[model samples]
Target: MFGFGIPELLIIGAIVMLIFGVGKLPELGSSFGKAISNFRKAADGKDMIELNSKKDG
Candidate 1:
């Protein structure tokens, strides 16, 4: 993907692991997932602020 081959991907993944560490991987992944979800919702014209207010109320 993105013009990256297997070796390039493995190297990038290793660098990420070194920077974030193994323990923080899950938390980072969860945050990334949430961000993608929010972006998709926003792209679909759903307002996040209104949704949050509704949830809180």
Candidate 2:
């Protein structure tokens, strides 16, 4: 998995925290989760586009 071990992940996490700050981490995590969910739905051909349009209308 891209050869990322615990030390590498901790370094990456520290970088992200420095950039986004602790206060916004929760918001960022939520948005990231939603993006992943949408990506999975799209990969499964779930017609997300139509569903979003229907909700808006």
Candidate 3:
């Protein structure tokens, strides 16, 4: 997507590390993963509320 290759990705990653710092990378990755998961669930019409309640019980 956007014609971004390995070089472009490396540059972008370096910029992100500079801006957010290495310590924050894991947090950022977790947040990104959650966002993608939520997006997929919403697109598939999955009910998160019910799933959460079921898991708790």
22 Cα displacement, candidate 3 (Å): 0.1
RMSD of each: 6.2, 6.2, 6.9
Better of 1 and 2 by TM-score: 1
Model 3 lDDT on a 0 to 1 scale: 0.92
Question: Which candidate comes out best when scored by TM-score?
Answer: 1
Model 1 regions more than 4 Å off: 48-57
Candidate 2's residue-wise lDDT over 26-51, tens digit each? 99999999999988999998845553
Clash pairs, candidate 1, are: none
lDDT, candidate 1, 1-57, per-residue tens: 689999999999999999999999999999999999988999988855653444554
Query: Could you estimate the TM-score for every candidate?
Result: 0.78, 0.75, 0.76
The segments of candidate 3 whose C-alpha lies over 4 angstroms from its true place after superposition are 48-57
Error of 3 at 56 (Å): 31
Provide the lowest-lDDT 10-residue window in model 3: 47-56
**Across residues 1-57, which tens digit of lDDT does each residue of candidate 3 receive?**
899999999999999999999999999999999999999999888844653444554
Root-mean-square deviation of Cα positions for candidate 2 versus the true structure, in angstroms: 6.2
- Per-model clash counts, in order, read 0, 0, 0
Candidate 2 vs. true structure, TM-score:
0.75
TM-score winner between candidates 1 and 3: 1
